[model samples]
Target chain A: MISEDYDRIDATLRSTLRDVLGLSETRAAALDADTPLFGAMPELDSMAVAGLLTEIEERLGILIEDDEIDGEMLESYGALVRFVATKTRR
Target chain B: MLRFGPDQGPLVAVALPLFEDANRVRGFAVAICRALAARGVATVLPDLPGQGESLVPLENCGILDIADGFDCATKEAWNANRRLYGVALRSGALLDKLALLDGRWHFAPQDGPSVLRDLKRIKQASQPHIRLSDADWYFDLQAPADHPDPPVEIAGNLISTALLTDLSVYAPWTPADGGPVRIVRLDSDPAPADRHVPGTALWRRAEPGNDVTLARLLADDIADWIATCER
Candidate 1:
């Protein structure tokens, strides 16, 4: 289970990727904190990406911007967590 | 042939729209499945013949065939569960209707005068795009004779007669159990009156295109819904 604190974002990310997407932990963890999700994960596509974004938004109570889709934030699980942390901080 | 996955709970079988293979399943269907799965509600998404990887020919596909296929898929795909929900998108009306309350959760959009706007755009576009299915029209609820024209910009400002005729008959499919049959509008905004209706979950955000806001909102909703349905 993920902790309520920001550190739990890792657990949240892992659980979502593994349980919801049925991805193996080895593959899921292979993602670096700064990797582009779409290009990195064969399972991630436009639709899946959209689904992930929505799930994240509703669960985290955050809003995403259209211009934010870049190679930086999506680079890795850590990257996404950092991005979420930045947004939550703001 | 349908795929089976050791159905246990009420089978939640989702029907993909025409020309939309498993790829489109990534968006809404996957969200719904994740939502249900979190609740321990097992879900199934089967690629109809001719579409997706099913290896069927396009010409051989029809609305009835899709619905029947959904039925066969549901029975064999899922183990006998007390409830079965069918979630269909833009063009999956017939299957949605045929699968009516087969004890399954059905997520669809409401058909009203507003849809004409979407159809008109499809008709007028210069490029050849996927034709909006008549299924949207089939679900339209008849507007009253006194019903005013829906705001011009509701869909895309090109409402047509066929589109009008279509919206008049649509009633969001209500199940026998009254358990929430979430009707979400894809690709359009809800009318002002629609905002106040209970059980009408509305989303007006434009496509997020991998943006942070889009991602955040989607993830939050998926997580919340997942949390909600799993329990």
Candidate 2:
């Protein structure tokens, strides 16, 4: 994917996490490559993860198979964005 | 039933999203109803069978049963000589198909299969050890063939196996199958819609929340659409 497309995916992933997790604008804006997600974020429990994935799929128009989901894909902010970017490329 | 605005004139019946989304977006839906009322349009939010305060248990109700309840609500409005319009959110879009209405407005409407997919994901998330197949996740392999399948609990909602089966093939009512229909979606969603508004998916929020701005904007959209349909 082009840099512009990657940027868009990055932004969408950020907003998806923010909206689904109910994070504030500032907190969402501050998310970076190293920002831990999933287990680190209390709001992102297993149930919330389901909603987050669905919202991401709807917004990005990408289908993420159950097998595609793993700890590494959702390890941190960058990992999640990369996983979505890879899906979009497909 | 929660009634809003004046008793006369065209009425907009509101259908909250199915299951947990209904709880998450109830306040937002109500805000939209109140906003619509402020625009001189009356609206009603009814408790569909198997939902809300309805005495019917969800496990015993089929998809049609809830749709029937919605149809009955609109029939009452039609009997009173009131022009009826439907405003549904998410899976709520599936319920208004059986209602008697001049037009239907859906916001981020989700089809039956999509709803089932979300439920399945939630179930999987809650029980990672259990392997569930898309074909017959609700059925128990050990149970006798004649034994009735038990309800599956997902995200605190006990949904019937029959309903799950129905959802796999259930699609929202389109204009080809019904009266005039309008679809609106959030800007973030890439799905085709008549119009896309700037807002996050409130129904996706983990905690129940309200979006006053989104509600007001949607109310305006609904009011304008209803006016056009009335004409």
Candidates in order, TM-scores: namely 0.41, 0.96
> Candidate 2's C-alpha lDDT?
0.88
Please provide, for model 1 over B37-79, each residue's C-alpha lDDT reduced to its tens digit, 9 standing for 90 to 100: 5555566777765455666554444445556667767665344
Q: Which whole-number lDDT from 0 to 100 does residue B37 have in model 2?
A: 95
DockQ value of candidate 1: 0.03
Q: Candidate 1, which segments miss by more than 4 Å at Cα?
A: A1-90, B1-7, B20-25, B77-82, B100-120, B127-172, B175-188, B191-231
Model 2 / residue B213 / CA error / Å? 1.8
Q: List per-prediction Cα lDDT, in the order shown.
A: 0.48, 0.88
Report the lDDT tens digits of candidate 2 across residue range A17-39: 88888899899999998999978
Question: Per-residue lDDT for A20 in model 1?
Answer: 38
lDDT of 1: 0.48
Candidate 2 lDDT, B1-231, residue by residue in tens: 899999899998999878988888889989999999999999999999888998889998889999988888777688889999999999999898788789999999998888888898899999988767757887777888888988899878899988898898998879898688999999999899999999868788767888899999999999999889888
